[model samples]
Target: MKERFRLWSRAQDASPPRIAAAKAPRAAAISSASRRPALPRGVRIYAVGDIHGCVDALDALLIRIANDVKSSPIRNWRIVTLGDYLDRGPSSREVVERLIKLNELNCLIALKGNHDVWLDTFIANPETFREWEPWGASATLVSYGLDLVSLGAPDRCAALAAEFARVLPREHADFLRNLRNHYVCGDYLFVHAGLRPRVALRDQKEADLIGIRQDFLRHNGAFEKFVIHGHTPVEAPDVHKHRINIDTGAYATNRLTCLVLEGAARRFLFSDTPLPD
Candidate 1:
């Protein structure tokens, strides 16, 4: 498993595509009358983008964030990882292990992504691998010591999924299973994907929360709160008046983004050293 994980490490180092500058309107300084949401006084939130099995990037980003915290201390700090922690890259096992470790160290809020839901669905019915494989699930299986060709028969697929259940660590399984759909901190709403337009946060559908793309992505109206999400990969942290997307395609681009929020201030931190303005 270790050797197989190493083989794909180089793939994780490739630079991400440069997105045409984010088309969103430039955010201006917040004033007392500003409509934008704000975090609770004294609370600092670091919302990370979709990881997609890039353990190396994730580790680097975490260290960067820890260093940032050390430089400027805050009383309350939270780490919110928008999911897709599996698939696409190498070391899905390592990513989950690191997340488990992070949870022990900080106030961690892990949200479920569509890929994670697919994994749970596959665990319930291995036949879904037919659907999951093409969407990068094969990489996750490979990390767990399963070969794609080995699941040729439906029965074999089911058997392999059972074996996966037995082999996957209980801590990781629980971490995935117990992930939240969304978390509300002060005035910001953290979700794995964009929410359905006009739907109240509490009334949002599960599909929209973790899977909806275009409809949620294109909406320009205000949501119940400022929606901080991942799922739809943007070239950079696309900040708009209505939403903020920070996925940055970590698995393919090797740049994991983190959105930092304190009071009404917003900034970005990536896997690399240069911080966003």
Candidate 2:
């Protein structure tokens, strides 16, 4: 028997082929060639979590932000998504596209999650980013409309994979061009994953930056700046003063969350919106 696989979507959501009827976009999504994000006075930073391809929820997250934010003299704000932008949901392609659009509009700092590194490494390693083995780690292929169930039979899957091979998003490829590893501030270090436990920052490796979680979480380690991150999905935004894990696994739950802060104040904003499987 051939290796059997099921697509993540159901009939109501539209099959991969029918979804393929509307291929993923490859447009040059970078809007304004702006260099850096503006850090204006009284600015608020909306640090977001793992989107997991739920564009609708992301839109709602921002919409809630707009409605809730009171009008003021200086409304300079930043939208920082904590990586894992692709995979595990129905709209990974759409999420990336929207992020590109959002980046063009405001100050956006998209960090690199472990999944991102996996995808990027796959893309960079041509042997891994091909028809026989296109990108499909933890539901990326499904999110990109290439899951076997959606693509049909084995032969049909191969053909569709070949076609997807042709239409990979240039914008997404560009989006992964130079993703930042980690960010540091006065009180904390913002990372996609987390830091190694009981280790000094100077001794941490890039892999440790986006790969170590259990060790960091289980072990008792101290840091100069509290680490704020996403990737570990808990019931809530995992706010514990020292390290806050904000990845609420947005793709499946549809209940995406965010972490908001103004200089010293730390608060969280979340949106509960159901999405297509």
TM-score of candidate 1 relative to the true fold: 0.85
In terms of lDDT, the best-performing candidate is 1
Candidate lDDT scores, in order, read 0.79, 0.62
Candidate 2: which stretches are off by over 4 Å? 1-41, 70-73, 124-139, 142-162, 273-277
Candidate 1: stretches off by over 4 Å: 1-33, 149-155, 274-277
**How well is each residue in 42-64 modelled by candidate 1, as lDDT tens digits?**
99999999999887777667666
lDDT of 1: 0.79
**Residue lDDT tens for model 2, 82-189:** 788776667777777777766666457878776675555554443444432333343565556665655553445445546455667777777866677777655557
Worst 10 residues of 1 by lDDT: 1-10
TM-score of 2: 0.71
TM-score of each model, in listed order:
0.85, 0.71
How far out, in Å, is residue 163 in model 1? Answer: 2.2
Q: State each model's C-alpha RMSD to the native.
A: 6.0, 12.7
